[model samples]
Target: MTILPDFRYIRPANVDEAVAALAGKPGAAIIAGATDLLPNLRRGLGEPSVLIDVSAVPALALVEETADGLRIGAGVKLAELALHPVVQRDFPVIVEGALAVAGPTHRAAATVGGNLCQDTRCHFYNQSEWWRSGNEYCLKYEGDRCHVAPKTARCFATYRGDLAPALMVLGAEAEVAGPKGRRKLPLAELFQDDGAAHLKLAADEVLVAVTVPNSAKGLVGSYAKIRIRDAIDFPLVGVAAALKRDGDKIGQIRVAITGSNPCPLPISTDGLEGQPWNEATARSLADRLNKTAKFQTTTTVGMRYRRRVLLASARRLVDDLWEKAV
Candidate 1:
């Protein structure tokens, strides 16, 4: 049986304490829900010396409205976020993403912050240590080269989070606290293109909350994904769209995609605005997405199949948003 390594577990009373606890402790790892961390630890994917548990930090569990917008505490459970009346009414796109995560039992324990900060996934890297021992280790672990692309110097693990694209389209921001103090940055800025260094957050930092603008409340949004199963399976290709309407014409629109690349790719909607939403226009955009989607062989799902789903899902989302608007 796979066993977790011996480690120190620390629980801080507040954000300040949490940040202080991580100071000078380079080997310390943060844990909120442990839904993702524990599994990786069991597989010997990481060997941190200490664990800082922020699950019981009260401030991180709040979900409220502030002058900045809707504030979602990082510690809020995925199940609570998915079923909350406020989220269901104003930000259904977020609810859609939350509901799509794992199974009901998992959602009950998984946190929004943990979901956003989850590691990039790869078919080769996610296997058991015994299974991985059959071949050379990849770059994501302790390997010298990437198995997916040996000639390439970087890891190609795919980001499969369902909520990232949804939040990206909504223009969310992440609130982080660390030894350097608290700072906020665009949610999109938190992700990096390298699979081995997927999250840009420092080892000493903790993501405290996510803030969405009030402007997003009135926008028509949709989240869709293609997965092997309805439960527990990660997305093959997920797409999210948020469109703002000026009477009948589109005022602004944002489209974000995940499960296709190292980070969520936000499509340029430069020419899409000011055009009427119709089947013809959607077909044109769908064609463009088919050409632009960059697929990697990081999952069992074939790259060609994922490309097709990306195009089809984009078109379907456009059609769905159009149907909801008028």
Candidate 2:
């Protein structure tokens, strides 16, 4: 049986305490819902000397409605977000994405922050310590080269988070706290293209909350993904789209993709606004999605197959959302 390494546990009462606990500890990691972190720890993927529990931070568990939009605490459970009446009514896309996350049991314990900040995955990297040691490890951890693309000095692990794509499509902002104090930035800016260092957050920074803009409310949106299993498997490719229709023509639209690249990416919808919602336009959108998606041999699925499915999924989602729009 795989055993977790020993670590010191610290339960912080508030965000300040959490940040303080993590500030100078290079081997410290924040844990809200251990759904992702625990499994990785068991696999010997992380060697955190300290695990800071932030689940009891009351401010991080709130789901508040502001005049601008909604403020979702990072510690809020996925199940709670999926069932919240306001979220269900105004942001069904988020509900869909949250519900698509593992099974009900995982969602019951997984937090919004944990989902958004989950690690990147690759077939070669997520293995037992013995398995990885024999395989010479990958670039993501204590390794010299990326097994997926050894010719390049970059890791191609895919970010498989379901909520990030949905949130990105809605133009959400992330609130973060650190030794330097608190700050808010566009959620898209929180991630980079490199799998080894995907999140832009510093070791001491804590993701506090996420706020969706009021302008994104009332937009017809949908989230779809292809996963190996219906219940617990991570998505191979996920697509999210939000549309604003103006008399049968597209007024505005945003598309975001995950499980394809190191970070969730928004597909450019330029030249798509004011266009008729028809097959031709859908094809154009698909073409754009295919171009934007950068698939690699990260998951067990073939790269080409993932690319094709990403396009098809994006096309289908856009067409369906358009048809549903008033």
Candidate 3:
């Protein structure tokens, strides 16, 4: 491992203090668990003058259950999230995603906020700087072209955050603290489609918490992830779904697909609502899965293979939901 570049470190006493520190310093970066940021800094991907530690901030580290939903603190570690009983019970898809993110050692140190707001990644972009330069740079890095979509002006890098799809399906909202004040937005709105700019979060803002609504509503939830290794690897394609069943009928369904864009794609098309929970609806979903999935050959897998597997992932989730309802 390479040594991190020289930078001043600042730890605040609270969220307000942290915000002040960030606002006062324009080039400062927030650090929670430092599992991902440290490595990126060492590799020169981020060169902030000050590293503002937000772990000391009380509100940023809290996990509470409100009347509306479960609130997960941004600074809560992934290991803690995986071990939380409520997370496992109410949001099994989230636990499923968090449990497999990296190994136990890495998860022990990686924060939930870091994972949700994690950096966008690509096979070529994550490599060593020297390696990237040799390839003449891709759209995500020093290069002018997107290797995956040469003709397209946008970066085709993949968003590998395991929990995003699940959270999207769960209808999560994020509370962000900034110099202006704190505000909440739907978690899905926080992400931009461009791989080069994964988050809409500002440099001076820190994601404080995520609110997950509670409603089983005869719904069966499932998440499917495909990675090279069992853990510590990013998903090539991930599909998370929540299907509400009314007797044998499908009352409502929300499907989110990740690993295609800089952020997960939440398929909000109608017709899935109040449909028969029969084989026909399941088959129809499989067909629509292919049409909405916009994938490129940006990772280890081939573009065609990735596209096909997305369908498989979607079908499997839908099938699992259907079987559970039965």
In model 3, what is the error at residue 277, expressed in angstroms? 2.8
Task: Give a tens-digit lDDT track for model 3, residues 1-326.
Answer: 34677778989988888888887677788888887787777665766889989888777777799876899999888889888988877778788878767788888888888888788887777776677777887887678988877898988777888888888888888899988898999899989888898899988898899998776424567788888787467888888998777766777788998887778878864887777765787677877777777787778787788777888778777878877866
Error of 1 at 82 (Å): 1.2
In model 2, which runs have C-alpha deviations exceeding 4 angstroms? none
In the range 140-250, model 1's lDDT, one tens digit per residue, is: 997788888899999989999998889889999999998878899999899988889989999889999999999899888989989999877889999999988777888
Steric clash pairs (candidate 3): 102-232
Model 1 misplaced regions, further than 4 Å: 287-292
Model 3: what TM-score? 0.93
- Candidate 3, residue 146: how far the Cα is off, in Å: 2.5
Model 3 has an lDDT value of: 0.81
Best-fitting candidate, scored by TM-score: 2
Candidate lDDT scores, in order, read 0.88, 0.93, 0.81
Model 2 Cα lDDT, one tens digit per residue, 112-209:
99999999999888899999999888899989999888999998898999999899999999999999999999999999999998999999999999
